[model samples]
Target: MSELHHYLELNDPVAMVWRKGNSQDPFTDRNDLLPVINGIITLLEIPSSQHKVHIDGMVEINQELYNQTSALLPEQFLVNYANGSIQFHPQHEGATFSCKYKGKGLILYPASRIYAMVRRHPDVVKTLQEIIDEAHTKLNDTHLAMDQVEQAIREAHDASAKASMAADWASQAAANATDAAHNASHAVDSTKLLFKPAVSDMKELLRTHLNPQVGWTVQTYKDGIRYRYDGKDWVPIDIFGKNIQLVNEHTDGLMSSSEHSKLKSIPLETKERVIVFCLPSYLFQGVQNIVARFPFKGEIVGIKAICGVPGDTDSEIIIEKSMNMKDWHNIMSRPVQLDAFSHYDDGQAVVDRATVYAGDCFRLHVVKQGLNIQNVTVEMIIKI
Candidate 1:
């Protein structure tokens, strides 16, 4: 068995001895002679613009007094990284400063007379010290200002981050609102399908369920008329109905189709199966029952229709007919014979026998009048 060497985190050996029966280790040791490294010497700070005192001396600054003043370095003398010698020109009129020359070495200060002026005029040291102290204070203030700038930058960065987070939250809120609106729309559609009125026989269904006591005439609609109903009284439905702001100040579209409010419409045709009818333009709401008319070629065996009010305001649907389109009579009205055909929340449906003479076309009228309510939807299912 043999032992292995183990090293510490600092890679220093805890113990050293002969290995593998060797007489001595393969390393030699000797005393390490190191020079004393003194603390860094700081130089006095002064501007070169006017402080530089050129003293062509014959000697150098005394090692004991060199680089011993603490002050802020000038803008030109400040270094980024690595260390280098920077000249500090202090404010002084005399050439008491000295430096080493190329070949001559020791260059005496004051050229010849003041080779060591500071050494002789020792009182000058006190005055120079005072000047250096003032410079040190200025430099310290500059450092403090730089530190404050860094702190302001950090604070601004934090504020910007918070604003970004707030924006993200606002975006999330908008997305949630959109989802809720979409779900509410879907629920409304489901409710409509659940409560939709369904009927197969038009004539019998109307005679048994509608105002058979009143005159009932089939109001023919143009092709492609859409069917719709309101959940509450037409009062609430008025707000939902697509309306054109009528500036009653001016008379418009008295008899023109273009000026009248447009309505959703469908085609009126003779078909073997049940078909839907539609009309163009707004509903006829007045004593006039002439809102829309349809003229089909063939004969119709069965006819069913659905109609209702669009506002909570009271109104009536009068389906009047005239063989000559001049004198007309009603076949069906809402609220029995006591009132005309109408509905505020519920749909008013009717079925009746309607036959068109081969030579004479049938003329149907939709007369309505009252309030601001003017439009309603009607779906027709006719069997040929």
Candidate 2:
């Protein structure tokens, strides 16, 4: 029998082959029949003129979207799909531009020609069938791989979500620990005030005591006076008595009422302290405001201004003191003037203002600024 008859007898495999009238020629073209697409927009290398040139595949000129007539229409251009060549319209001669399209057109053979070849070599049909089956198996494997990748991605997302939740819990735990520590510290401070030791005086108390905590107290046996260490000094406790005599520190003798009154009028020099604020040279434009609080009962004894660098001009630094942050009055009789590279101090003079109690607000207003000054330090002395 003929080879064609023998092939046909083997379960009619020829009928299972591609039924398309024009099948791509695997020998002369790529294994895949589909054209390779140029997905990105790119410039056309060849001139889009009347000359017929092989573009390698179908040409999709972007100009078509703008002017539809300049497309693959029969009246506008001539195309040979079999050879992948195109001849542009005469009107678009020698035009160079960007174009995007698929490359390498499929080389198709007529079904009649393939049938004739299949009759001479029936094995060719079987080989083609085997290739199709192998391709199907590979496509199935690819689908399985894609599914595994998707599952891995889902697992990674769940792990990330758990990590974020763990981080949130850790942050909350840290905040709670911080609050507990703060409460413990406050409790320790309150306990220190209630549980202080009864020592003779500050000298003997500090000899053994390492931590001289604030608000702790000490008593002197000789004077029968109880003094509290108010952070800076061992202040005498305010005790109301019917008959109290003022005694000197060196000589424990009774003091006259006049001497006691004078002592009350002016605070001791050792109890004087300073509060300093430095103003940069750049802030010499307008009025600068400063607000401070006195922690102890005191009086503003003095104001001093010191310049670090000398300038060409002098500065009349007008210092005004305010108790309520609204109404203000000059602390000096006139504006304090500081020469170049000099210091100005309003001597320890008490104004008509009353003594400032604890928690009282003191504000200073600097009205004028020195020109080209390098550094300015303003110091206010308080007598407690």
User: Mind giving the per-residue lDDT tens digits that candidate 2 earns over 1-384?
Assistant: 101112243443233121122333211211112222331212222222332322221233444352655444322334343344445544444443222232322333323223312444335443454556678999999999999999999999999999899899999999999999999987765445432656654577668566666778666554456666656666777432324455654433356556756677884457787777776543243345466666788886776777677545566665555557666666555554666555553343334554667766654444544445556777777898
Give candidate 2 misplaced runs (Cα > 4 Å).
1-152, 155-270, 341-355
Residue 94, model 2: lDDT of: 47
Residue 335 Cα positional deviation in candidate 2, in Å, after optimal superposition: 2.6
Best by TM-score: 2
RMSD each, Å: 43.8, 31.4
Q: Cα deviation in Å at residue 173, candidate 1?
A: 84
Worst 10 residues of 1 by lDDT: 99-108
Candidate 1, residues 260-362: lDDT per residue as tens digits? 4332134454365433334332333223323334454344443333334333234444344455655655544441111234433244434343544333323
Off by more than 4 A, model 1: 1-309, 333-345, 351-353, 358-370
Every candidate's lDDT: 0.35, 0.52
